[model samples]
Target chain A: MSDTTESKRLTTAQDYASLIDKFDTFLFDCDGVIWSGPKLIPGVREVIAWLRTKGKNVLFVSNNASKSRPMYKKTFDDFGIDTTDDELFNSGFASALYLAKILNFPKDKKVYVIGMKGLEEELDAVGVAHCGGSDPAEMEYMPAKDYTSVTPDPSVGAVLCGFDAFVNYKKYSKAHTYLTKNPGCHFILTNTDATFPSGGEFYPGSGAMSAPLVYSTKMTPTVIGKPNSHMMDAILASKDFDRSRTIMVGDNLETDILFGQNSGIETLLTMTGVTNEDHLLGPKKSSTVPTYIVNSLGDFKVLVDESK
Target chain B: MSDTTESKRLTTAQDYASLIDKFDTFLFDCDGVIWSGPKLIPGVREVIAWLRTKGKNVLFVSNNASKSRPMYKKTFDDFGIDTTDDELFNSGFASALYLAKILNFPKDKKVYVIGMKGLEEELDAVGVAHCGGSDPAEMEYMPAKDYTSVTPDPSVGAVLCGFDAFVNYKKYSKAHTYLTKNPGCHFILTNTDATFPSGGEFYPGSGAMSAPLVYSTKMTPTVIGKPNSHMMDAILASKDFDRSRTIMVGDNLETDILFGQNSGIETLLTMTGVTNEDHLLGPKKSSTVPTYIVNSLGDFKVLVDESK
Candidate 1:
């Protein structure tokens, strides 16, 4: 436990109810904060519904670039949570938004993608033209030492990297060639998460998938994910939200708590995901402490019971 | 061009002869110093054979790990240069030697390889049992989000990374899982060369291939290649060579010349490959200045002319 961070712990139903009442907007992170895997964390859906009933705005800000907004909606529906497409702001959408709005990417140029179909969908949503991602040609394993086909495409003005299950050397070589050979080519990364928890284990994340391109190209990507300020800037640009009245609730300290802190918003740490009490109280206390800590986001289900 | 570096330039045949006479042994980088693409650099063969006739030791020390020693020997034969298997010290062979001699890799445990057949052959020569390299299953495009097949194998004691045209997400997940789950698993890299010149263009190198695993696993590999001194250490342990009488000749300053400098030996830079005159005397002057400079190693053919 580090004395540097004085975090308030919510225990009773009054504390949970009081905490929710303070913010008009609540930002939730999906994986560990709402649902661990396939099942929804007990009481989370009830708490979210209760928050909505109180006219509180809720947004799901996730670093999971693997899923586009509509794909995430399906996951929400599968979990029996009523989440609309408009309330989600994932890294994939943020990346596309950054290219379309912030950079004002040329309409004629295309983005070389090193990601999944979800990322491509987001690019398409923003009317940003893209290539390579989830393309059957890019997924093919290039025969050893044959990179003649991996030449630079002049039409590619930017390289967008994210989570790609089909990440292969051909994609890396082509991305490297584009970033290196093409003048003024923007290197964009959805997020820099090292690993994503999947199927009861941590696998390579979107960041890991883009590491090779980063190494080979020797270019630093403009990360459009949490804690980078880009996502917050994008949200602020489009959505009308009072920053001071918003609270970010997530499981991971580095990604979630740090993101809120970077964006100048209040943050709540939930223990239902990647972090625990030891991370806040133990010898290796994380530097990024939250404004409030709770055993689980589901703890606020007591508010639902009170409503009944 | 920097005044901090007072390098001697060799021009005349007498100057080239004096430079070769000063060192009993020579370490040459293959790419630009010996050949460029499929064509052999003119006069390199004559210069090398002449150097051998004078009883001077010549070792081809290359960061190119795409080819094992035998494959390199075949290339040497194609170029009309008589280089024996023992005269080559590539990053691939250095990696195997490092594992067998320095680490004393356990015979029972296997190394999960993320490289090519050349890398596998080198590992085989050293008796390091390996899996995953060139495995057709590992190269297959794992249908999106299906990481169930990629599980932790306790038998994997080390993860050796090198250049693999077939490098895919399956290999990345497997390497990540092995390093994270397997206790005390060593991470090894053949070399950290960001790119390799092939077909007259630069492509992603061995280092880029392993970047994903390095990122996901959050592990620093023991790199057995140029500029790291691991290759020099391997050379010193296996061959009886005098450090004071050796000179490293290469085209690139970062990998080859810096490698020699790190090894406490003299370095000679040639102007036939990835570097040019501006690198030494331009606005973007490289910090790594070699001990000597030559227009090209083929310029040493002046010594051959003098002998004729």
Candidate 2:
């Protein structure tokens, strides 16, 4: 809002639509750009409908990996929109796909996941065998329950730390002790966010909690979330989308903006979730910047109509 | 085995007893020193018994905060050692205690935790109310999980990150988003071990996974683990222990030796855990060197007797 005229790069939704028409690739943030909280912003469905009418290719890129593709698909359906699993770009799906490609993560690999069902399904889709400590019979899947309980056998080759309800100091301490004792093991984490939005408040995320492990182990995680090319690489390999023709849009800077930057696609910023223009102009703004900005999806229709 | 003649620091068990008699307080690591992989290390029980016989004060300092004092007390009882809740020091406990002391963490203030039951107990002990999303059924207790699933509500004055199983990309992304959104929120963590000795091969610890959150938040966690002095502070606050008459023993360099150095207590390095003597005598050895070194707890006992 400050000094809007002083910038070399201030763009409107129309500019973004023209770029999308030219490039044929689109990426978007979920929370702020398309919707806020659970309610879809105005005109988003219509704008997408217009884009589909124009034969423009689009990929919804989100760093949010909490939900599965099926859930997202359902959400879109509920909103009177059409989206296929192949057309979606989620951090969890991308992460699993990449691990399968690069690390030869086998369908038979006994993956002990500490995440929601979304991640578990992704692993299942990849034919990766996994279990959580909660599954009574699968309790053996967990090696250490942080610092409190040692549930799984400590001899497993890898320990995957994700989002879970049972995270605690005892569990973490146990996990730390186990990992320290066995330095040769593999440690995989989904993302490093400190907190997330729910209902009307924020909650601590994996990033906030996982930071300590990074310091203790001196090992960087094989991050499978946005801004990293692992998910993009997997999406590109799927052949359902063309990389050069795709545009990425989102509200967040690090993941949503950087995803577009990393993928060489058009980026759009919506004033809906997690990020705003002030953040984009702030010092922490990464090397990646969105190609366009719109007040809301309702405004985006105007851009699409003008482009036509 | 290295050239002992050239070493300026004492590097034997006998050297340890003399140093122990000169110190007033003692700290010990839980994982490698007291027990490794569910089994107590050789002669550790005896050495501790000998310490008690000599009227030396002892403190069990662990970076793993997943467990509460009562839990440690049970473990000690299993190990044939008598201990009280105050004698057991964990990062989670210390972090809670320290936050309560400095910030006057309000009894009604909403504390968001990304940890386990032990962490919950600690927060409760300090008279703090917590909110998390993991268990909606616990709504009577504010049924909130960590801050990962929700937005940073202004009502949340403090955010605590610890070991969590539901640590995922969305959570990580959300945590980062919230911290960036609200910079005034107090950020706290249990420990920074890169990897702890999990029962199996090494996996990611809290420190490694929490790196991104720490970076994004631009806040350094007030560590409650060994070497941070929070545990020592807790020990000193107890009526039974005298700070000037205690000592510390462990195998890890950073946790054990560093804890002793930081707390102004004598330190003894055991050759049973994460670090070896080579590291202590290597080029990386700082002025904060251990006062003595021993091969095992058996040798430590002999040194103690000889000093007597």
Candidate 3:
């Protein structure tokens, strides 16, 4: 184990010659890698422009499925970084595509969704079905935050999980009971972020909602957000891209590091996200180490430019 | 699902004619089915005598791996039922055998066991190696509770989880960390009983110790006890048993019923155990339901006598 002071004092920026020589595509995690909360990190725009001028592809990836692709593009544009819907990847979008491919979706395959407006809008754009009404026997129902309108049915094909403010104990208990009674039913959680930064203090993330079900039913959810390969696969299958030339950049180890490791992509870990130096030193440090560590997105660009 | 009242009313003794006709060897669950806590349930002794008189094989089976075979045998003998060590099947006993067979254990395999004196005795009797120290750094360590100890070496050959009194947060965090670092290391849990009855209150069981690791590492433990076929195979493989004729009788649906269901042996459900009418009406009450629902163990005598 490395000494704490030594690791912290070690410059996050170093020679990127080898790393730049190895990759063409750049994937950036939104929350910490590019911006903290709604504010853009310093020198993030310049790095994107540099990458674009170097003819490298850039994708703005986020595991927060609460936001749509358009929302992501808007956020990047608002932050003075150039991006488009085509260059955005959200787990909710990927999840919709995944379910669509497997279930042979109908315009009427009423999906019981539990998420924010962005997720619902994405589902609507995909022409997938949705159900959330007063009827208790309905085949589909959407529960967001409170989900007072939604009642569980054994026939509900799948339960979708995402970010929402209306969630409460009743919703969780119902989901638990329903899934317990019917183990064959599918459970799709957007992501497993334990806590997400809000105003001042940290608020519980989708992990809080999914943890109980996972514990009780002993089921591993098929996550469809940032750092998971599900989103990567959806993007690659839709676009004519070379996976070998792709490089993934993120700030969290469990999700981002794991995503890159599982997807066979080069990963650059940025110190701008939820995982701090202490977190790294803790037992949670992944066995799959990052290929590069950077203090900021500016450092990422320096490596890219210098390597070429 | 059937109403609770109706399900309760439906609980009645059925002739074990069909079940006895199918299998000759009988396996009984000790807790609830035969005894509750320290007291033997009514008619338990007569039933065993009747089965023995009819020349049917009987084995005392339980998921509680906290105690050794001799302890259970002693308990039964004290309760007016004569039994041999060979007739007892506990997860702890099976776990030692499993480690001995698969791991190429040395004469002194030096294990870190996190269970009771029974588990330690079983390992000693098998001539395998073990240490039952509380310190994480004291060689190999097993977790008897959700939190017990953590090893700093980051490399232990195996982690055994069983029954322990002092479970806390620190131990779980360390064990989970060690597991993440050394993915190849083995995990052995005595049983997966979510909660067991103790002192008129439900307390977390072996499942609590095993589950957290299983969730974090995404690695399932090599279970050594009930519902798992390893012990059954170990017992039937012994000199006194015949594979072609064995009957497993118990009360719990998920563990006992499913054990018999998967093992291709006839099963009987007694009304005196952990499971009740609620389980019979829930998902587990389908075609996999027990072949017989006897009011008490004494009913077994009638079946055996009739067979004679």
Candidate 4:
């Protein structure tokens, strides 16, 4: 499904209806497309409900590793949108599921998490014991002069990285030690999103947090998020989905549209978030071209009303 | 001066004497060439003393930004080596000098330091008031949710980074805010050394600390250290020296030897620190070839004794 000149802009209600009819499954990126932050986009809730009424499979795929699936479901519930835990696939949950179910992580071995509580909860839900994340001892600043206190944990089989607020020298020191000292220790990251938008400003994301460990160890991690096939693999493994009938809808082209292109899925770009009009048509436009472009997910509400 | 077969290995006392006589100035990298961590390498003190006795200019040039010149002089004093503050050139000092002397930093504006006391002291020494580095407020972990507290100081004209022990999200966020919000806020770093050796282990260095800001702001800093001409410029500006008659001696080829090569001076590789013999002779040999190689600086003690 290429973005031909005629099909690129879905300005008409008939265009929206026809595009919706083409796909059986819709993968949504939550932060930008459906909502900006705490507030919901005007017509997004109605459009999602309308999609469910049409018996379409709607799944929320997010690179936010700070929140678990259930936590994300709570946010959906608070927003008056009914979303099940099974319908949500976040990077944190994907990382845990990949380690536990796919890699068949040893029960005796533990994972060293350089992330937040959400990643820890996901790992716990999968019965995978973890250390370092939210650990009070690790949160305190440990100087390099006292690095002797940062002893190795032999039981740690994997070092997983995400957006960590308590990222310090100690955490990096221990993670580096684990990757180098432990033979065949797995190095995993949720996503390499360089910057994350929040409170109307961009801040350093998970990729920035993981850079110290990357530099110290000189080892690249297996990234399991958007633009990487691992998240799609986890989603595909959990449910039966046809690639030809699936469409990825997102606001950012780098992670969202690129993820869809990399996964061989059709993509839709919504202009309500990080991306702008010139991002696709500008001189410095990205290679990840979306099949369809819409002003907002709210624009598709016109199609639902027309069908009614 | 290039690495000829005869001068590659200074095995004999006569070879050592000839090599010492070849240069009027000797720039030494402290870590791997002179000593490793708290322990001093054998014969290094004697050779340094012998070089001073020959009326040759001896300068201790290091990328270690964790300590100030006075603090570093204390280390030399502890090692029983008589050295003046003017004889030392470190990254922290270079960064401060680069901003104050070369860049002509605004006297009204302040610098935001994302490093330790050493870097802060250097900045203070130059009459440049700075915030963040070693500041108790910046040391604490500031969560992404409460980024509102990361208020930007409009008076901040620069964000200088080095090997910071207290690197956290707060520092990166504040630096990002300053770089993005302030019109002409400078982004400078002491060095981009990915990792530094300490106690037989490689730890995240200055580059790692600056990465988060680099990722968030998408800005490159003016790096002032080895392998860059800013540090050499500072050295040359402060003292009279003949570039043709000067030689750089270090254990690492990437930084120290590369520094010499980039600065158009002769370089000698010592095998006692971070690099090995195969590093130069193997398939992955660095492009920055050294003019000479020695087993250790201790071998030069033979030359000291021969002079006696």
Candidate 5:
């Protein structure tokens, strides 16, 4: 019914000025947009600081639940980027918020977690009860034939999953039992990233960690990360902002751009991360197109140049 | 294409007599048709012994790759069932055979394994050089932030995976590195069973174990187990049998019956384990129709009823 396919590119200082003038709120994705691995993208600090000077609400929306909010803030501090604690809303925090605020999880029931300590911290921060994650007992390997420990846990109301380095068959068996045997047990994931890029290659992500349960139980999980409206809601609850005056800026089309669209907002795509010029214009173009395009978020530095 | 869909049932002495006369060889599925867990199905011993007495070529085709040929023979010995070491063609053995004989894997290149000791034994039996599997170092867990240990290895020609209770981040990272970094690296699985039923419930199976790689790499591996023709070829390689004169006997229709159909052989469905009367004659009837059906493989013990 409407045209949202064409993405207008921002070039000159006038273009950047006009783009910034349209939105009072800006949501940014971290890994690819702000930095790559441990290396910070030049001018990222200048542009974000300029956004704060312009009285714009700058918040970081990250899908990585490998670290808690404080840890991410530490990363930002290490990068010398001026940002407050309330400016970050990661998938782990969103998932915890969904369970605590949106789902209104029964206080009596507990979550059977298949994730890292960061995810467990998020749940605790939200005042929700959880177990299994980072528990040495759950990490131990029972012989392949042993399933005696995989008993049905009636107390587990949800099986919350995220990235875990210790993902094993014991965790899968327990998750499978909870989903299959427990009545009305929810299956939730922080994000369904198939793999995460690190050490110049990809390793299995949170989605892959919980894949065994998905197969055995034939159940699809409610992903609480980018491209899902739940993450958007979590951000919205953090601060009141006009939806029309907000735009999501990131490097990934599948996650960032699609996420903005899912949240009923505009999106600005960048080429500094997983995407490139060919991705948007080549024969093998991605289906998830953004509302606007830019060479990189670093290009926003033009706004801070008084001479320009 | 004559229809091999409708299944005939054997009830009377004449029916059993005709059924035995029709097949010169019988391929039996161990877990469901012959036994359930540790308990052997009634009349299984009698039926197998009677088949041997009738000069029928008896062989076992199993998908459980957690055990090697010797281990499976030990299981048969524990149950007091009559079976030869060569009579069994498990998925692990099939996978090893596929790597060595079918694929003609280079002796200089080693396979990166993500499985248990049995799978390793099978690879060794086939004289295929391999690494990683059942290795204590691979079972150890590293910090979530550490990927320095996942450097690429050029010597790996393939990544062979099966069910492993000790599956952890190290094994996944290594497998991912070999598949992504190594050129022409093959991805092979012992079986793709989503879940294996045990302890009165289902647990993650071989397919579930490799799911992360499938999702991350966007590549499908060669599934060497049931419903795949590789298992059939492995069975054929072990013994001389006429496909037209042999029947595949099993309880489950999806794996066993489909495997038989893929092999261009007739299949006999049994109702002892996993499957029941309702499975064949219910509203949710399975699409994989067998050539013949029986209330139980034990009914074949009618041959032992001298009075009848």
Candidate 6:
């Protein structure tokens, strides 16, 4: 809002329609852009459906690594919006894809998962062997002095972390051991989101879960979610999409808008979630400015109605 | 090392006797200085007794927060060393003393503790009311989505974190809520030691336990242990000790030696524990150089034998 040429506030129906025509592919951030905690943001369904009807490619790119694509598809289905597993690229999928395709991980080696079932499922989907995640044995708290039984598997070539509800001393200890002892072990994290808004309150995110390991091992993991290029690489590698003709739509300016700007794609900021107009115009305006701004995706319904 | 005049390697018995005569008060770091794990370092007891025979004030200053002063005193007793609780200063005691004496916390407000029994005991010793530490209800793993039951007491004015074995999502969630919601709520951490050597292997320390909360809250706690002035302040306030005439003795250069350097007191580094000669002379040489270096505290036994 400091009169930046990149960000133009859309105030008219014609403005919305013209912006819609500029992009052939649309990427949406799940939490704030489309919905917020179990309910769809007003008119998001209509906007997405309208985009699909117009032969525009729509992809749900989320930083939520707690759920796999199939699990995410259930949420879309629950919201009455049509989405396939392939159309959803979440942090879990991005991490799995990055390991399997980009790094070309050894088939004999396994990934030590310090996350949830969703992350493990994605790894399994990509035929990447994994251990430690959601394992009942690892979930139990072991005394700090008792390290006789805490042994690392030599086959673990990578350690991947995401959101795990059962994050305990045992898991961190094992992850620390593997990272320190295992030579050439890859350290990867889905995202470093400090907190995620949910049910009218903020909850600890994946970053909080991975922090203990980072502190103990003194090693920063390769983050693969929003604001990092690994997710973009995974999306681009999996599908053919024109970056020039694509625009990112999200509510959070830091993660979502910045991700778009970093990926060299146009970004549209929506006010239905975490960010607002004041955020862009205020002294604390984020470094990454969106190309366009709208009150909500519901405003685009008027554009769809006008086109009809 | 690096041509520092402060660090003089003690070789001859005359050098050891000269170092002993330089300082009237001797501060010791427990883990590496006095003992390693469950066993006492050789001749450490004789050296301590020898120092006391010369009318020197012996105080144990450790970053370990897992035990209260009395509990720590038991370790000395177990090793056949005569010591009183008042002669010991640990992170747990430092935190409580800082809150009760330095901050002069409001009598009506209770402190929320995210630590073990030792931290709770020290808080109790200072006549401070605290909640959450070692509480069975708080130790249970609550689903990330469920925050309905996790409530903060309105009287909570401080959040203290230490080496908590029962650390879980619920405790972190409640602590975050108290920190964000409660007005003037202070955040305090015991020590930021990444790893502590135990049972012949390094394990995650109190800092690792506090990392999750640090990440989620995005707030750095006032650390009250080695290398921080608060611990030094706590020790100074409790007793009348002349900094010019005192010397800190320990094994770890980063924490123990740095603590002495920050406190304007002389330090002696021994090779009996975590640090060695290479650490002082290598590329990773610590900024805080000790006043004297010896192969072990047992080397001081030569001076005692010569004096006898």
List the candidate 4 regions with Cα displacement exceeding 4 Å. A1-7, B1-8
lDDT of 2 at A139: 24
Residue-level lDDT tens digits of model 4 in A249-284: 999888898899889999999999888867777878
For model 2, the stretches where C-alpha displacement exceeds 4 angstroms are: A1-21, A99-111, A123-130, A133-190, A206-219, A240-245, A282-287, A303-308, B1-220, B239-247, B272-274, B282-288, B294-308
Q: Tens-digit lDDT track for model 6 on B1-308?
A: 35546578999988988888889999998877888878899998999998898999999999989898888988899999999999999999999999999999889999999998888999999899998998888767887557656665789999999998778878888898898878789999999999877667777889999998899988878999998978999998798988999999999888898899889999999888889767877887667678889888888998778878
CAPRI quality band, candidate 4? medium
How does model 4 do on interface RMSD, in angstroms? 1.5
3 against 4, candidate with superior DockQ = 4
* DockQ, 0 to 1 scale, candidate 4: 0.66
What DockQ class does candidate 5 belong to? Answer: medium
Best first by DockQ, ranked: 1, 5, 6, 4, 2, 3
Worst 10 residues of 5 chain B by lDDT: B1-10
Worst 10 residues of 4 chain A by lDDT: A1-10
Model 6: per-residue Cα lDDT at residue A198: 64
For every candidate, the chain B TM-score is: 0.95, 0.81, 0.79, 0.93, 0.95, 0.95
My TM-score estimates for the predictions, one after another, are: 0.94, 0.70, 0.51, 0.95, 0.96, 0.95
Native contact fraction of candidate 4? Answer: 0.61
The number of the candidate with the highest DockQ is 1
Q: What DockQ does each candidate score versus the true complex, computed on alpha carbons?
A: 0.76, 0.25, 0.03, 0.66, 0.72, 0.67
Name the candidate that leads on TM-score. Answer: 5
Residues A242-276 of candidate 2: C-alpha lDDT, one tens digit per residue: 66677676777777777677767666666667766
Stronger candidate by DockQ (1 vs 6): 1
User: On a 0 to 100 scale, what is the lDDT of residue A167 in model 3?
Assistant: 39
Residue B266 CA displacement from its true place in model 1, Å: 1.9
Q: Please report the TM-score between candidate 6 and the true structure.
A: 0.95
Please give the distance, in angstroms, between residue B11's alpha carbon in candidate 5 and its true position after superposition: 1.3
Of 1 and 6, the candidate ahead on TM-score is: 6
